[model samples]
Target chain A: MTPLRHVFFVSDGTGITAETLGHTLLTQFEAVEFKTTTLPFVNSPEKARSTLDFINFIAKDAGLRPLIFSTTVNDEVRAILRTADALFLDLFDLMIHTIELELGVASTHAQGRAHGMANQQKYNSRISAMNYAMEHDDGQSTRDLARADVILIAPSRCGKTPTSLYLALQHGLFATNFPLTEDDLEQQKLPSSLRGLENKCFGLTSEPERLSQIRSERRPGSKYASLAQCAYELRQAEQLYRRAQVPFLNSANMSIEEIATMVMQEKNLRKPTF
Target chain B: MTPLRHVFFVSDGTGITAETLGHTLLTQFEAVEFKTTTLPFVNSPEKARSTLDFINFIAKDAGLRPLIFSTTVNDEVRAILRTADALFLDLFDLMIHTIELELGVASTHAQGRAHGMANQQKYNSRISAMNYAMEHDDGQSTRDLARADVILIAPSRCGKTPTSLYLALQHGLFATNFPLTEDDLEQQKLPSSLRGLENKCFGLTSEPERLSQIRSERRPGSKYASLAQCAYELRQAEQLYRRAQVPFLNSANMSIEEIATMVMQEKNLRKPTF
Candidate 1:
């Protein structure tokens, strides 16, 4: 058997993307055993030095080709890693060329210029909120909820939790999402917790078919998973938003990033990370 | 009131970056009111046309400068939006130039090239798993748990959820995370559901100081928020991983992306994106 391959993911700020992309790459080689490590939030040269030292340690005994997935802002730091005995791939390298060609602009060496450019803080916060909501679906989100910067109201599976968390991580916004449960739907009013924050309210609507497809992935064979039921709930949810005078967006084809951005814009919030 | 400055985020697959950047830019102008909308997964010419139509509709009524933040693979499609009356900000246009200069390489324009090069699917899975773990903090992941390509184990506030979600959104891997609760700490055994899946296990550890700082944000004055306690738990968790022979990564400074990438590489996954 081939000795387990080792790969390193180096990041500029949070290391989230490097790890995410790296994990996907690893999944393709189920047969090859490998070892992996990440150096997160490597924002400075000293941190980069530490990362390089660690990489050297990993490469010393490993016989196979070491792979690197990195998003580095510092050329000096990236230069140091170029010397590593490994196959290196970085997203910054891939995207910069395209950006220059399209915009007819030269590249700048400003650090953190691209850092918050993607709304990372809001993205992280919303991701956190989504994870929090999913784990805490016991109806506890209603109380002590002032920390929530925005509350998303939508029927089941309209991309609520994911959007919320995206807002949190990308903007440092505390986002909370409440399902317009059947009772809220029947009553056709916003959730009781969201009543006073109408100015901060935004809605996500999706085509019933799309919503059904996503729901099917988690709860197949349930009424919620059926196209008909999904359609009904979506329609009810849309009506609720309309009656409640809340601004809404259709998430039928939007990515989580897009959803969070739209909500932030609608709420007129300027996120910290981007 | 100044007409809300309108910003449109158009993306190739998921309009995440476009929207996120757009949201951040809106924040720069404190005096101006702003409205934002995200067009997600707009990877085709037809979608671009529809997006243009929407822009036209908004322009007719809003009479404001529309900022377009776009991420596109097809140059032709991206060009269609150039006619918009608003200040257009294409995400690819901004970053590509910088990336090429940094890497000293011209990129090839191959279809689906971006997906494989960046390895987004794996990150998506990690994000999904992180989201699942956050919602299911009671120490249970939903069905399809076995599908996780990699599982993360860490104590509370150890950056497990963010790392996992980053993996999911970016990489599309089936990543699941389990928190090392007090019970697990005392028992020093894997979760009952995770016994047979040891081959897929990876651990995230952090310096006690870092963990304490993170937790302090969530709970200000409590025993659980004590730095001393955090240090003890981290030590105990390290011992547990050592005894189980589960390889671990210290996330004291790693970004979420880096951690996911390391896990992917360690697993020896073949393709960049599954």
Candidate 2:
């Protein structure tokens, strides 16, 4: 049996970037089991040394060399962390050096700039986008449908709300979602509020079984959660999407991230620049 | 003046991981300006070749090498992209190779696994947490506050809502936020509903000037948006936090990510494991 390998994501900031990249890399090695930990806000040499000690202790306890993925930008703290007895992958140091050589410029090596509120304008806009999404969620307010970058249309519980919130919070896009009611689906047309916004409308459909299962968790044993009703609603929603020329995707097997990415690409929505 | 460098994030999936890490790396070089683009869903060799052509064209047009940060896991596609006329940084290839050697096992080299829905249970919980956050936003409903992993409290416009949603969506934590009302501040006590949940509570406070500025955008030329009102409210909230012994932070300058990470750490909230 393969032993569980220990991995550490160490960063001077929130360590989210290191953890994100590290998780993606670890997912590639499916045969190996990994126990991962994140050490964030390790901005000082003292903190770095203690983190190193903790990592070494874990290595000794696990009887394996732990893999360390670090993004610490402070020179002194990074130097301290580099002395650990493991495969220390310095994410920032090597890449920053290469980019510096290529650009003929030296790096500032500043810490906490990656996720800090450095650009107030962009930060404020991101918050505003989140507000926009919350206000417009589930067709709550169609008063400003014209302001939406993309409007997701789907039957209830087909994964519209999460995708809308993800787009707004992650990319600062003005996204909104609307649930297609039985009347709209039976008519096989876009909702009245989305009449002229077909260009910005994206539809999501799910497998009948999946939709029924999700709805069952909300309202058990109801016709709304029945497989027959779900299948009918999805079939009608797809027909409406085709008639309206709205791009759509099946959310049965896709994550919200994947769904959001495809919607953004299909609608030519650009992520807001900081 | 520094010449602008073009950077591309190429991936077989959503390319969010590539863009996120690449953005962090580029932020270290404060002197250089970057014009970045993301090419997501590049899962084929044909797509890789076309992406290479695009990167090379930009390199030629700019008279400088364009930087390519890629997370494509397919061998054929990655090989084709490696031939681009730029500084090609393959995020997965080198790290996976090293990890494979360390573990003495071959990587699956699977495409689209980074952000795919490989784990349905975790995905469902994340969606549930998002719904919980939305239901409990701004103290909208406290019916299930007992199930929340953390509760964030602050006066209006102190950034409680966005932080709560981010905590739920990103970390899969059941998070709820309450906007401290004038009555609660005047009484200098926790809300009646939050009386027994002090251990699970975290307070957020913002600078008076910043709070007033944020409120001014929402309700211009109103007493609620006045600097004096903002100062008084913040002071009362902080005192309430101290008296109730709820851990808190000043959110005036911190990004939502920073604030979320700090709250998680302080509250000892472990990110849900898949």
Task: DockQ for every model, please.
Answer: 0.11, 0.71
Stretches off by above 4 angstroms in model 2 are: A272-274, B272-274
Error (Å) of candidate 1 at residue A220 is 5.0
Q: After superposition, how far is residue A189 of candidate 2 from its true place, in Å?
A: 1.8
Q: Say which candidate scores most in TM-score.
A: 2
TM-scores vs. true structure, each candidate: 0.62, 0.98
lDDT of 2 by residue, A94-211 (tens): 5877878888988888888888897898889889999999999999998878999999999999999999999999889999999999999998878898888898899999999999
* Ten-residue stretch with the least lDDT total in model 2 chain B: B265-274
Candidate 2 lDDT over residue span B14-69, tens digit each: 99889888889888787888898889999998898888888889999999899888
**Alpha carbon lDDT of residue B65, candidate 2?**
91
